[model samples]
Target: MRKIYITLMLVVGFSAVGIAQEINWLTLEEAVKLQKKNPKKIMMDMYTNWCGPCKMLDKNTFQNKDVADYVNKYFYAVKFNAEGNDVVNFNGKTYTNPNYNPAKANNRNSGHELARYFSVRSYPTIIYLAEDGSLLAPVIGYQTPQQLELYLKLFKNNDHAAFKTQQDFQAYAQAFKPEFKN
Candidate 1:
């Protein structure tokens, strides 16, 4: 009976550990507020409900333990619906989806003003923002765990500061050895 109790406790503890290894995503407002208290680069997964690649990114790259841990540790993760009706206040501007159609919520409704402000033309654009909430870059498309890991580390380490030209980024990409597996 004593051995069974100890084994059960160990199993429960291990299960809890597994459950805890996920990205702690926050709302845009929450992330912005938190940055004021504890500054960290913000990573926004700007996606629409109708995007197929966006769904794949959520299931594959974002779900990877290594990717989630690294992003959670170095950046305040935000999952923003680019077509949603939520009003976002950033950099002294209020953005909203004024043309959002409730009847076609799942379809490609008009994008939010925030998405247009950032010039996000594609779905699943991961927008990286500075600690002060300024735009760093917008990485468009679906990336595997290995592919996304490179950008995560590059921006987190501020390695992009050294790039003087497009060639410089290309060189860095060529030399990058992705350590994360899909």
Candidate 2:
């Protein structure tokens, strides 16, 4: 009985060591507030409902355990819909799509002006921002968990500030240490 009890305790403890929940994705407003307190970088998954790559990113990339753990620890993860209904308060004013046309057959809405402000031309443009809501860079494409991890660390470490051009950043990204190698 003593041996069984000890074995059970060890199993439970080991299980607890690597268990983690889903990504604690935040709203833009909440992200800003958390940033002020924690001073970490921001990773925004700018998405739309009709986007295929956006869904893929959510299902495969954001759902991965390593990705979730790293993002939750080092960045304020934000899921911002390009055509969302929530009013965004930024730069001293609120922004929303006042001219959204619901009658159109396409999935277009009068997208949130903030999306336009950031010049997001694609559905799943991942925007990395500073703690103060300033734009760092917008990565436009579908990134697997491993691919996203490199960019996350690069921006988190402020390596982007070292680059003089996109070519320089591309060189750094090519040499980044990915999380899945372990």
Candidate 3:
């Protein structure tokens, strides 16, 4: 009976550990506040409900254990609905989707003012921000785990500061060796 109980405990503990290995997502406000307490870059997934590629990104890349673990360790992850009615306050200004129609919420709707602020014209745009909440860059499209790993590592290590021209970024992309499996 003692041996059986010990085995059961070990199984439960390992299962819990597996289940706990997920991205710790925070609200925009929460992420900004946490940045003040402990400095870390912020990664915001600006997506709409009707976007198929956005859904694929959530399922295929964001759900990957290696991607989630790396993102959680280096950045404060935020999932923002670009067309939703969430009011966001950043950089001493408030942003809202004043023209957001509830009936068209799931379909194409006017995006939030903050989305316009970042000039996100497409879905599945991953916006990277500085530790102080300033915009860094917006990577548009559905990026696989291997593809995003490059950008994650670049920003985390502050390698983006060295880019003087578009050619520089292209060279970095060409030389990047992806460490994550798709």
Question: For this target, which candidate reaches the highest lDDT against the unseen true structure?
Answer: 3
| Global fold similarity of model 1 (TM-score) | 0.89
Per-residue lDDT tens digits for candidate 2, residues 20-135, read 44789888888888877888888888888778999898887887788888888898888988876667887787888777665632476667787898899897999999978899
Q: What's each prediction's clash count? A: 0, 0, 0
- Per-residue CA lDDT of model 1 for 54-124, tens digit only, reads 99999888988899989989999999999999998888888999999999889999989999999998999
- Following a full C-alpha superposition, what root-mean-square deviation does model 2 have from the true structure? 5.2
* Ranking of predictions according to lDDT: 3, 1, 2
Best first by TM-score, ranked: 1, 3, 2
Could you tell me the lDDT of residue 66 within candidate 2?
85
Model 1 misplacement above 4 A: 1-20
Model 3 worst lDDT run, 10 consecutive residues: 14-23
Between prediction 1 and prediction 3, the one with superior lDDT is 3
* lDDT score of residue 118 within candidate 3: 94
